[model samples]
Target: MTDTLLTPGAHLFQAVEAALAGGCRWVQYRDKSGDHERRAREAQQLLDLCEQAGARLIINDDLALALRVEAHGVHLGQGDGDPAEARRLLGPTAILGVTCHDSLPLARQAVVNGASYVAFGRFFPSRTKPEASPAPLSLLREARAALPNTPLVAIGGITLDNAHTLIAAGADTLAVSHSLFGADAIEARARTFTTLFNQHSST
Candidate 1:
């Protein structure tokens, strides 16, 4: 299967538009806390942009908003909804991702519970949410060994500086945040990271 790379954390339409310019295939809107009305509006705008760009948009931790906006998918952490329940609510075609942190057992359970992809992270120091659990490269290695066909996403502190190392460690997707959109020129940052991602894929 082709690797699925995601560029998340674009807080503005201009930033997200810039990311699309840089060839981002999948984007996720991941605001941890915000007013409901504002979140829904932002998600709707993002969904429209993603549709125009032909990129899939996944909402982070907001299933109801995602469903209301008809987003391409929804990513849920352990504190969020159960994957099986999400599947039941979203139906067979709706994409669902689960956050497994550093636990393989939880990952296996998520897959069985109907998660389309599993995300694990904090592989490096993360400025976005420092309190998120610090996972190890060893987690990726083990995850790959156990679930080769399943899409394994690595998040947190993923930057161009250490991207290749993470890819080599067996991450199918690099779910990044500040590394790309936390900048003035979102296109440039996205292009740089996408270029590095392509290089590693070609290797």
Candidate 2:
């Protein structure tokens, strides 16, 4: 996730570039500044960077921007828009992710609505969204069982220390923000995060 505050100004792209170089395969452009021009420019740049690195870029809550930049996909929060409509517009190949919070029912609905993946969390305290409702680790387990075929994303307050627990509990992806871009060594942090998944898969 890209945050203007976390990585202000040009540092955003630099941080993302470092992450990509460190084996990060997916990036979600998550600036909520409402600056259409800047967002579009940054999203396009991020998309280009991701493409060059053989990674995927997902625009957050901005279907129009995603389409404008021809991004890999768009992630929709509950109030963002209709996932089915997004799916139709993005076509079958685009990756559509829906933030289902802690509800399995919402996740199920998202899948039915053509979401490529469903996200659940705030498993731990979140700096990005402090007031966001907390989701239990068991939610990941339950979602895994219920949405067996869909990719499950664990979001909110994810860090290297606690990331393993989420993956162990059945989270296919970890959506991190502060802990990653806020690190002094963004590349190393990203590499370590990627290593966690690799180590888990090998086991």
Candidate 3:
């Protein structure tokens, strides 16, 4: 599995290109800027780049933009509209992910509601969402046992220094933002994550 999940933030294009160059197959366009026109334009651009790389682009929130850009899918948070509705909009072929925030019930519900993958965390202190609740590794372990077939994503402050623990505890993908994109060497930082996943797969 290509588990390096690069989530776009401030430096959208730079972040996506660098991640894809490092062999990342998944990129989530996570713009919270609320500039509808700009977001649509960027998503359309990313859709082109991802298609060329054979990577998938998941738009964060904004179901309309995901459909307009015809991205791979849309990721929904606590109140980012209905997952089933998003699924209907994107059709059966598109990927649909949901943030469960360390709750098994929520994860299960997301799957029931037609989510393609489930995400958990703020595992560590996050530069992106510092006030977000911390999700324990125990949640990941339990989630793995609870949802065997579905992939689990671990997010928030996931640096190389602590990524191994999440992988070991049962995270299939690490959703990283600034810890990845803000680095002086973005491609190298992305490679570290890809390396971690590759090593895990080998073992």
Candidate 4:
């Protein structure tokens, strides 16, 4: 997932473009600045970008903004909103992903409540979310056992150096933010991830 985080400041659009340019098929618009007008405009812009790139757009934490921008999905954190109601609002086909942290039970409940995917996080130290909840590589394996059919996203501090471990442990998507966009070579960083993912799939 591509996130417009705190440090990347002015280059948010460029960050999304960098990801799309690197053949990223999914982009999550995660800006938490609480500026409704700007966020809506930016979200619309990203929706257009994703449409042109054939990339899926997942809005983070904002159900209205997601629907307003007609995003492909919304990723919900614990305090974001209720997954069931989000599913109802987002419709059957709209993707709904939930952050499960390190809890298998939360992941199970999310799936039961119609979450299309579950995200576990902070596998490595995170600059974006330094105080974020920590999750183990073992959690991914356990989550896979519990929700075999559900797509699992491993978030927080995921980088090319350590992402293979997450994939090996059963993470379907590595939710990268600062590690990809915080760098000057955004496209290159993204490619590293895609390359890693591709190589893993082939093996």
Candidate 5:
């Protein structure tokens, strides 16, 4: 996930490109700046970068922007919009992710509403959404058992030290922000994260 504050202006694309170069296959453009024109331009640029890297770009909470850029998908929060409606517009192939916090029922509902993946989070103190409610590791375990086929995303406060716990608990994806783009060596940090996944898969 990309943050406006962390990678503002030209640094945004640079950071994203570095992450992609480091084997980060999924990129989420998550700028809440409310500048429609700028957002559209940035998102389109990100889509192009992802395409070149054989990666997928997901626009955060912007169905229109995702559609305009022909992005691979859109990640919607609880109040963003209807998942079913977004799914209908984005079509079956486009990935539709919904934030379910720590609620299994919400995750189930999101799936019924056409969500391709479900996110849960704040497993640790977050630099980017500090006030967001913390989700328990048990939630990921339960959600995985409940929604075996659904991709589970764990967000907030994910770091190299603790990310493996989330994966062990059943998180298929880690929606990181600060720990990634905030690093001095963004590509190296991203490569480390990618290595963690490779290590996990090998075990």
Candidate 6:
């Protein structure tokens, strides 16, 4: 299991490179509501950076841009796109992730519809965006028990301080943002997260 971090609101190239350098294996280039051309361009830049760093890159909510860049994956929220449609468009090898929030039903549906993984979140206080629902730690426990083979992702407000709790709750991956970028020592904080991830995996 690994903890994935999405790039924060900052210089895309710099952030992507920094995260990769700090050992972030998977990075999602998530930018909401930007113009098509700009978003496409940014996604491409991030993809290039990911390629150089040997890290997988996921584009958020834009299948078209993802397809254009041939990114590692595409992450879709409930209202973003039909998963089956995305699968059809992206072909068999493309990785697709669906935001399940707190619903096991939605997670099951996503898996059936060809999602590679399911994301649940806003586990703690979130300032990035208005989360419609808050998932509890128990949700991860239940989902893990129900969907044992599926890769489960925990998102929202995750930090080094509480990452162990989420891992203990059966979260396979922690999707983080602000906390990683907000630290004064980005590399050191990322190393802390990597160390925590190792410790969690060992336990």
Alpha-carbon lDDT, every model: 0.82, 0.94, 0.84, 0.87, 0.94, 0.80
**Counting only residues 3 or more apart in sequence or on different chains, how many pairs clash (N, Cα, C under 3 Å) in candidate 1?**
0
Which pairs of residues collide in model 4?
A: none
Clashes by residue pair, model 3: none
Off by over 4 Å in 2: none
Full candidate order by lDDT, most accurate first:
5, 2, 4, 3, 1, 6
For candidate 3, write residues 145-183 as lDDT tens digits.
999999999988889999999999999999988777777
**Candidate 1 wrongly placed segments (more than 4 Å):** 1-11
List the candidate 4 regions with Cα displacement exceeding 4 Å. Answer: 1-10
Q: Give the TM-score of candidate 4.
A: 0.95
Q: In angstroms, give how far residue 18 of model 2 lies from its true place.
A: 0.4
RMSD of each: 4.4, 0.7, 3.5, 1.5, 0.7, 3.2
> Which digits, one per residue and each the tens of the lDDT, describe model 4 over residues 1-203?
54554335447777788888987888888777778998888888888889999889999889999998899999999999999999999999999999988899999999999999999988999877788889999999999998899999998888778999999999999888777777788888788888888998899
Candidate 6, position 179, lDDT: 81
Candidate 5 TM-score versus the reference = 0.98
- Of models 4 and 6, which has the larger TM-score? 4
- Model 1: ten consecutive residues of lowest lDDT: 1-10
Q: In model 2, which residue pairs have backbone atoms overlapping below 3 Å?
A: none
lDDT per residue for candidate 5 within 49-155, as digits (tens), equals 99999999999998999998899999999989999999999999999999998689999999999999999988999987788789999999999899999999999
TM-score of each model, paired residue for residue: 0.91, 0.98, 0.93, 0.95, 0.98, 0.91
Report the error of model 5 at residue 30, Å: 0.5
lDDT tens per residue, model 6, 1-203: 11224443345566557667888887877766657787777777778878888888898888988999899889999999999999989988888999998899999999999998899987888766455588899999999998999889998888888898998998877787788766677667777777887887787
Candidate 1, residues 22-120, lDDT tens digits: the string is 888788887765578877887898888889989999988889988899998899989998789998888888889999987999999999998889999
Task: Give one digit per residue, the lDDT tens place, for model 2 in 25-112.
Answer: 9999998887899888888989999999999999999999999999999999999999999999999999999999889999999999
